[model samples]
Target: MSQTLDMFATDDYPALTAGVDEVGRGPLCGDVVAAAVILDPNRPIMGLNDSKKLTEKRRERLFDEIQQNALAFCIARASVAEIDELNILHASMLAMSRAVDGLQRAGESVKPEFVLVDGNRLPKWHYPSEAVVKGDSKVPAIAAASILAKVCRDREMCELDKKYPGYGLAGHKGYPTKVHLEALKTLGVTDIHRRSYGPVKALL
Candidate 1:
């Protein structure tokens, strides 16, 4: 195991340290989703890595494993309206805060003493947290959070595909791909499209 992963497995960290991660920040449509996960030390999940590095099948499988094995987990999001109102960075922070807050509210497990968040920036919240540049890859808890957040958001995008159609949301998950851009140009923007985004703003 790598140094970081090894540290997590050892007793060097807090007993109740939650891992935080977010997804869909780059998507031009759909909400930015975030997840907070407190993994059980006794229930070690193998193959935990950055969600992007894993296949969809792997992520989906891990998503279930994390939810079933973790002491507590919560998924949260900032909607398109919130994203436009707060801007992506602040909106992403809001989503992350919500995820952590939701876990705290669940009251199913002991409160987290520390938080480990992916990315260099921490949300404007009261939680004692440190951001690791690639925490999702280095920390198993963060990796599990990444998987849950990604799977939840991807499923949402697939549902949006059924509702919106022609946008290829299921395929691209609202990223500004060639197909998405073409659909935007032809079909114009939907209510779900983030108007503050460059492509959507241009169309507007």
Candidate 2:
């Protein structure tokens, strides 16, 4: 008989819980960023919500607060090359895994007794974790992870916009928006683009 894997084996909240989330999966460019946050129950930061639902000002504020208050937090990413080579979904998993691993090595690392990952898929890892639908909004730690990953990715895209101005990366953050597509058509694909993506591959 084959063994069964129970994703919710660790559903009960533990004293040390790490929430994992990824950002940039929908973008045609930029690395997929992931964050693992082990929030300190005693240092809770209110107003936690899915990063998308939060205003820019609120996200920025929470970003700092999460870093300051989390028992351990790590932001990790799979680069454009990794995304192109492994494909976005696998790359996202890799980034998520890396984030959790980083937390184990964090300056104040607290090995999580359980993990809650945002979205419907959980990365294959040794840690006991569950995949939660819309967990970013439902779980405080996941919300904090989303905020950190989003803010970090947004800032990186803004910096890249300075290097490659025509894509409006700062505004669209590398998503395949009309402006970004138009810019890609006129400017041609840059090195930062994921060559494996259909839109980018067509251009090449």
Candidate 3:
């Protein structure tokens, strides 16, 4: 119910289609995640906020609602290797681009006229894009996308936890938390970790 969120809800625009948001760019292990969401303006969800601001349970609930209600949606990722090769920023953009491409591939006839991305840096893509600072908190569509990306990346990290038992991936979700740093000190880097990252590279 913030003023910024309210503004996006009321903004008049043609073909206000999918919004884009990304996650995991800063993680030392795991892929860069992105999501594209197209909200139904007629049926806006209540209590929409940035994924980081919501509880896990709330985000899960919103994720389900978004998948069910949105006209089209897609989640995508750029692998840690890809992130290393392209650098995190470009890799994040590539992930977003892949999400947008997936939406098109799924037969969503209407292309987004404008893509509202959830950060100050805009991705280089064919479609027109606007980078909105704090967009996930301000725009419902971006919020939905953020939830999807976070959930998706969290799931991936959990899977990695099973593969690398001592890494605490599930607990930290591969971020550079104190616990994660401790784990890195003990276990060193895994194949899934971005060796190019400063903390991870310092281990080398």
Clashes of each: 0, 0, 0
| Candidate that scores best on TM-score | 1
Per-model TM-score, in order, reads 0.94, 0.92, 0.92
* Candidate 1, pairs of clashing residues: none
Off by over 4 Å in 1: 1-4, 7-10, 104-110
- Which segments of candidate 3 are over 4 A away from where they belong? 1-4, 104-110
- In candidate 1 the C-alpha lDDT for residue 33 amounts to 97
Mark the 10 consecutive residues where model 1 has the least summed lDDT: 1-10
CA RMSD per model (angstroms): 2.0, 6.1, 1.9
Q: Write the per-residue lDDT of candidate 1 for residues 81-198, one digit (tens) a residue.
A: 9999999999999999888888843456446778899999999888788898888888888988999999999999999999999999999999999999999999999999999999
Candidate 2 lDDT, 1-204, residue by residue in tens = 001112233346887889899999889998999999988867868888889988999999999999988889899999999999999999999999999988943465667788899988888889988888878877888888999999999999999999998899999999999999999999999999999999999999
What ordering of candidates by lDDT runs from best to worst? 1, 2, 3
lDDT of 3 by residue, 146-180 (tens): 99999988988899899999988998898899999
